[model samples]
Target: MATDHQGPATMLDVAAHAGVSRATVSRVFTAPESVAAATLERVLKAVEDLSYSPNAAARSLRSGRSNTVALLVGDISQPFHSQLAKSVAHVAEDRGYSLLLCDLDHSMDRLQRLLTVLPLQGVDGIMLATGDAIETPGIRAAIDAAEAKGTRVLLGSAQPDSSMALTVSPPFEEIGYLATKHLLAQERWPVALLSGFKGSVVSTLLRAGYLRACLEAGHSEKETMVLDAGFNSTSAQRETAKLLDGAAMPRGIVAANIPIALGAISALADRSLSVPDMVALVACEEVQLAEQLRPGLTTAGTDIGVQGEAMALALIDAIEGQAATARALVPHLTVRESSALS
Candidate 1:
């Protein structure tokens, strides 16, 4: 018996094994409908036997388009990102486009890697949800490179440079403004804002909006209250306890997000402080956990599901070569017993 030697297979190998031309093999992978059934079957069998995968770049070069989109988010575990993923996936599936998820975790280095790999992997467009400012040079270069290639890039949540294509994010500023204004309207003049990370874009906007409302209401700069809780429930809880223990606690609290709101609620409960009696509370995001709590939370936000849907729709439009425009989705305030005074 003679020893057999195998070498790495190529498109030529598949074509030879299938008894077809290299063009036929390429057609079978790129435009299967153009090839006959018998030829297609033979090419597929050869592909499997040789363990040959069509190079996506070559295929895109031939076909002129790739049916895939990339979605980059800050935190995959967060409810808001999870919801957005679901919505974007549904929309992509309906349009016969595939979605590639990339979680940047707010790391510019990670985002840079994604930019390098995404277009090479044949992504037709990109939807970025930075959740915070992305100022790194590498990440900026990647985004610039993708745009230069005519790859549609739609930014969500965080506003990118005006030169780059971006979609509008949820009205985070309005969320803070309305929540604080609502509290002030209810005679909660001294309102304390428990915000997320100091560097977060949403947090900065929300804090600014809160300050604007306070200033408009004739509240002095000295009386304006704010705390940067650093994006953790435990920290918010601890800060809430400390604030309450201070000489003069605010009558109301506006938490930037759901986790912080939950923490604030826990802190209040630990001290046996009744909501809306000792201190009223409102949050930026509405989570089911809030509703299940006693005196259900008064939130100036809508469902994450809605935000996800809007993001998906905008992404699809960008991918389809539609005009890049900002679309702001305002969250409505849902008044509940948590912020109501009896």
Candidate 2:
């Protein structure tokens, strides 16, 4: 059977090309695990050869679903967000759903606009990986509107709150506490937390953890420092430089994330300061390049993949008309050369 090159290929064309029934082709797209491996392979090959695409509009009409999910993140370029996106996308694909990845670009305005657009576009569900501005009233209004339009929503990096939507995230406060404690255990005094925006939920939680560690060491809140690093490398670098030039220098530093850690490392290098000897450094999350650097990064990290998978499954449960629940993954400290005491 020959498919017309001028128009789009259909399921029947794919079935003819693969020498299978139309139902077999449908099974290949919908429930592939039920099909024989060889038959699945043949149908996939036929789909590739004919460039066959399922008619989404017809499918939507038949199933009353768009079979698509949207993912919103503050910054996809960062290590933690990127890793989470990858894990969510993998799980979404396996569940026979398409993922629409949206970058908020660190803008509340953009997030608001996208919140409106996604429901309008008929995505079955939404997963927001919010790193900042999680408590804005405008965002809550947008989410309410989206839910009113019948789009299920899930919030990543969120705790169990009154809104009652499914939430999945790492234990941010614990990460902060453990990272700071790792430095304190080495007898590094006056440790500082190079953090994200001050008022954001993540920053606040991490600060709480930092304060907890400080108090445990018999240090008051005034004894420790918390600098706003603005959720990026450049800001982190600038703040770190100021800290280094101050009268009372910190013996240990807890960078909020990998990019911030990189920035702090750059600032230390500019001052010709040796890591671990002059100032021990630790990051709240681990990245792939952590170990490859001059000295391996000491980090407090959780399984990003596990968190993402949980988030995806929670959203899917809501999309399928089931009750979803909140989950928080635990974190652990990884000691490395950067935070080692000489």
Candidate 3:
């Protein structure tokens, strides 16, 4: 076993095995253009046989570059974040860079602390998901400090400060408007929204878009209901029960996220009312679950993987001093069984 020295084979092991100096081995791997093709072949062979890997820490210390990108997502459990994480990891690894995925679970304090130290640790770039990571006041100084230390930053969502920072955003406001409009187009009176908690930037924007569409269609708040369940499926269930039990049920509902949509469907099932037959349903964002459900969910189809890759590329370009900002993704509605009138 070439890596038999115990933990892992070092670069020196490959160098020794290849009959070359450690510097030659390093040059062959890092600056192959400067190394002779014959030496490169020998080193590559030795690298394969010894299975030796370069230490990122040592390389960063020697070159002042980490060749790593960090992605901070608010919640990995969310379908959107999970997709974003997968794409970011894939692209980072493909580009010969290590990826650090940090799921903060929506903790602002933890994100602030992480931002504070990312520069000192020589992280090459950062990809931030929405919410406190981009909106919190503490993160600005940290971002500035990191930029001064040569760590580039990109955001996964659009915000008020988006013009100042590179951002890759899906068609957010349009998604809400499209989903709500689809519900309204069914001629379903008294529409509602399962739009997460109040004061959330995402939920707020989505709600505003929904409201804008409704108002334009001559509907008022009296005919529109916005329900809050803290973005939890179980909470949405309870809220749905209260909505059905205590008040008149809206003819149509728009779920701000896939989870909320699932919860809403479950709640409706509890009442033995079939989707679209009893009430129309649509979700602002499409996910895998939307299609797999009994009544395929009508949704605003936003490509999350594209959003993640766009941000990753933007961050990489920024790191390399190339100005790159992604274009906003336009969402298209996917009509399905759930929103059909029965």
Candidate 4:
């Protein structure tokens, strides 16, 4: 629906138009104080266009009882992680809570610096979306200390000590298995798997999933190769170019992220080989470019926003002294022309 053309829009209506959760709309109107400044701006604009106003007084009263949740992200450029953050923002908004985003410098040491934010009274909880840094005991302990001081702590992905904090994420392994299987089903053999950064929890989980699919399909180890592409377009491109220079080309490929998938496509183009005709491809995360490609990319996608909202709610529940701890989201496959057989 168009932004400005709505009749007596409801909170849910505002969220639908904004591509966020209904609770987010409520948070915008009722708990503007608790909502993230960025989310507040977006929701306010949506409210104006929809010609709807929230019960500001009632919301304000509710906002008094709630505080904002903070989410720390190491890489906002990664499509999958960015999608998850978008979802978290909506969920936080819906619950009449604001979100604080801390863009880290991608160093474990920086996490220590971010810990200083936890002591602030306005920070109700802290969510760690840090990639490999979750493995660092210092980081984990610092987050735990925040929790000990009455701020709830949650994790978007796995950590070295999961029991120390609540964890929520999609079935990552299933996502990888599904993507790899899709490529294999296209009758493409010797499928190459472009795994993400070395030692990344997501990379390990996804690589295992891809291996499961290949082995189940009777493909041998030599038939598939795994590379540590480091989860960026430039790194992926460089790594894939080296693979392209090898003796034999892969007939199919499973990319663990959008950058790797795009890198693979670019490398193939440099060699004058056509996608899907010479090599079928699948991406683990769905992004707009997937649909915009010359022969659109097939991807394994999940309702990350919904999952993020759920995690937020779970954190809220945990803060309220309830027993909710963990939840897993399942991914759905989206088929497009890129992985289709000629």
Which 10 consecutive residues of model 2 have the lowest summed lDDT?
Answer: 53-62
Candidate 4 TM-score, true structure as reference:
0.76
**TM-scores of all candidate predictions against the true structure:** 0.78, 0.80, 0.79, 0.76
- Which of candidates 1 and 3 reaches a greater lDDT? 1
- In order of listing, the candidates' clash counts read 0, 0, 0, 7
What is candidate 2's lDDT per residue for 1-342, written digit by digit as tens? Answer: 556656777788889888999999887654455677678768867876885646446335636778789998888888888888889999999988889888887777667766755664568889989767566688888888779867888778764353745677777899999999999988999899999986577888899999999999999998889999987899999999999999998889999988898899899999999898999999988766687787899989787888888999899878887776655587988888999866
Specify the poorest-scoring 10-residue window by lDDT in model 3: 53-62
Q: Over 4 Å off in model 2, which ranges?
A: 1-59, 159-162, 323-328
Error of 1 at 26 (Å): 23
Best of the two (1, 2) by lDDT: 2
Model 3: per-residue Cα lDDT at residue 196:
80
Q: Model 3's lDDT to the true fold?
A: 0.76
Q: Give the best candidate by TM-score.
A: 2
Model-by-model lDDT, in order?
0.76, 0.82, 0.76, 0.73
Query: Model 2: how large is the Cα RMSD against the reference?
Result: 11.7
- lDDT-wise, the better of 2 and 3 is 2
For model 1, residues 1-342, the per-residue Cα lDDT tens digits are: 111227656778888888889999777654455677677768767866775645445435534567788888987866667767887888788877788887777766556656644664457778887667765676677788777765667777755354564665787888899999999998886899999886688898898789988999998878987898766689999998998898888889999877788789889999899898988999887766667777788998766666666676776677676664554576788888889878
Global lDDT of model 2: 0.82
